[model samples]
Target: MSDLILLRHRQIPDLNQLDVYRQHGGFEAFQKAVTTMNPYAVTDEVKDSGLRGRGGAGFPTGLKWTFIDTENWPHYVVANADESEPGTFKDREIMEGNPFQFLEGVALAAYAIEAAEAYVYLRGEFWQIADQLDRQISELEAAGLLGDKLFDTDYSLRIYTHLGAGAYICGEETALLESMEGKLGQPRLRPPFPPSYGLYGKPTVVNNVETLTNVPLIITRGADWYNSIGTEKSTGPKIFSLSGRVNKPGNYELPLGTTFRELIFEHGGGIPDGRQVKAIMAAGASSSLIIANDEALDTPMDYESVPNVGAQLGSASIIVIDDSVSIDWVLRKTLHFFSHESCGKCTPCREGTFWMKHIIDRVHQGEAAWSDVELLNEVALQIKGKCLCALGEFAIEAVTSGIQRFEPDFRAKVSESSDEDELLVESEKA
Candidate 1:
């Protein structure tokens, strides 16, 4: 409770209402920015705050804002609301419970980049949430917080909501831009990145819903205050989506450097029915399987620290795997998800995911030999660096990591004997 920043609205009843939010000091930061501060000043404040993107990559937020090409006309801001990652639902909660705050963050970012229009791109599954956000945007317009020339300034901004057809690939920024523009939702090559060339081929600032939601607070409280809360590199509070096998599973908001042990045992109420946690998936299906030993459990859950445990804190979607749950089964389910979600834009992701899925299915059915396990591992390796986007790379994380770290689980499912036994049989046949 002491370190809570993002989820403080949980304590405030009816905070979703415009008047209630205003009463609780809602758009005051945006107001301050629009009326008094210059655009670069706002961007500089965010830069000084040391806030990193909360959406998986942990990219520096302010640095990203600075990357927007100022010479370009009609700059745009897009909030990446496609929370399609399994076991990750923090963005939905933020939008549902604290819609206005998130919108204000969007507005502040729009102001920073001097963008006239901003869009919140949501997955089709979030239809209701999108509707709610649309109403909130209308309310802001009626209240003079959104639409044309806010707070008697020359600056004007408008926010819109667009729904995707549930393509998980659209979560990638360039792909998201492509989908928004009525094109196929496949990733565009980088370095003509979103900053220099984005949405409609103009400079755009595309940030996560959770990332934009932090901006108002950074502006209001000052950069030093935000910086003081989290670890040196990974600053500010993060809402870790806790799911699977935990007693009380939900979003637990804490500072960046909080340990996995505290998140699981304390906030999550530990494993249900006294089952031992065999492994911890730090970032949903995309995470490398982390062995749930005391050493790993004690490791702090931050962008800097989680990597020490052989996994990235990607999106911080912590899915606990108790001993009762076999890692092979987890891999099977994860592979199936990636296979189904593959955009088919490139060969590695398109064909690689399909091939890996069949291999995983065979292994899961106990119909594969020990060599098939090697083949599965090899296929994942082949797909590792040859993809068009992070989805392809993420597709192999659980497969390779599961086989390497939890070999016993995969080995148990194979019909054949050990490699030595198979070699002996081959020699006898010869």
Candidate 2:
């Protein structure tokens, strides 16, 4: 609604092409930053804009840029294009449609960090998108937009595209760096964060695709201009990948603070088949189920407000669930995904997700007692805060939240199983 910063290709034709992108004020920010502004100034502008990471964590983007270790030589930049989150397809669409802008954003970030090279680490499933981006990166280099000595200035940069082995854990910044370094895709220990030691053991700045994509716009327009679009805390427009029971399921770009009612009904055309909206997974499969009450629906979909509704606006991939579906079924599917995607890095995530999947399978099959449900909840709670990465924590979000918020679904499942068991016992006695 706010003039489509990331999805400009939705309005303009051929925006992915280098010439077409350049014609529409692309690379101007990179040019300005390289030719005139200092690297720190570009970072300061982004810091002032109040832009947070769109990659679930919602960490401050500009603040992250400032953390680059100045003492470390040959710093690096990596744009996380690993869009593996279930129900979140915004980054893939961004790469396929408005790629140059994303690349430009990557360039801006590289410049801000004074890095000579950058990598766009995409999921292996995004091969076609990676191919397109590869061509586009070549085009930028050919046009003197990328490569050494950019814009006739001393600043030099080169960006490359690396494909992950379809591992979701690689979406984690340190793991992504590890994967790029040709290691097993699992998360590294913290304290030496990516900013301090990353990518072959040097200081690095790793950003999400959507997060890096905002950098160009922030640099092009002043920080104040970009800051005015969204809420004070969650600035700029976010692309919500509305899916599931919605009548019209696709990406809807709107200001960060827009309410769920507005996105689902106003932009997403509401639920399908005249069914009542039952719940909202505000952050895709990794989200805690937000009960679709008036207060939850009216709640603003920002980093700060969404949590109050028992969910985080993690990736803002709003998966609507109508009354026609059961929350237990949703939980099963989400658990399966997380379990399969788990890299087996930590015992909690690896075994926890695996057992949770099996327990949810029994629950969904109507073969579990109420205690089984409680065990499921206990296992999920056990997984919290014990893993090396967010994957383990994310695995339990739907499990704990669904059991707590949608108790009826699980109760009906266990109740039906109990009734069947009693019938079997009576028949055996007879």
Stretches of candidate 2 exceeding 4 Å from the true structure = 416-430
TM-score (all chains, Cα) for each model: 0.96, 0.96
The residue pairs that clash in candidate 2, if any, are: none
Error of 2 at 143 (Å): 1.0
lDDT of 1 at 291: 97
Candidate 1 C-alpha lDDT tens digits along 1-430: 5735677579888878999999978999999999999999999999999988887898999999999997877799999999999999999999988899999999999999999999999999999999999999999999999998788888889899999998999998999999999998999988888988999999999999999999998999999999998799888899999999999999999988999999999999999998999999998889999999999999999998998989999899999999998888998899899999999888988898998888787778776778878988898899888877899889999988899999998888887655744643553354
lDDT of 1 at 44: 99
* Model 1 stretches with alpha carbons more than 4 Å out: 418-430
Candidate 1 has its poorest 10 consecutive residues by lDDT at 421-430
Full-model lDDT for every candidate = 0.90, 0.90
Q: At residue 177, what lDDT does model 2 achieve?
A: 90
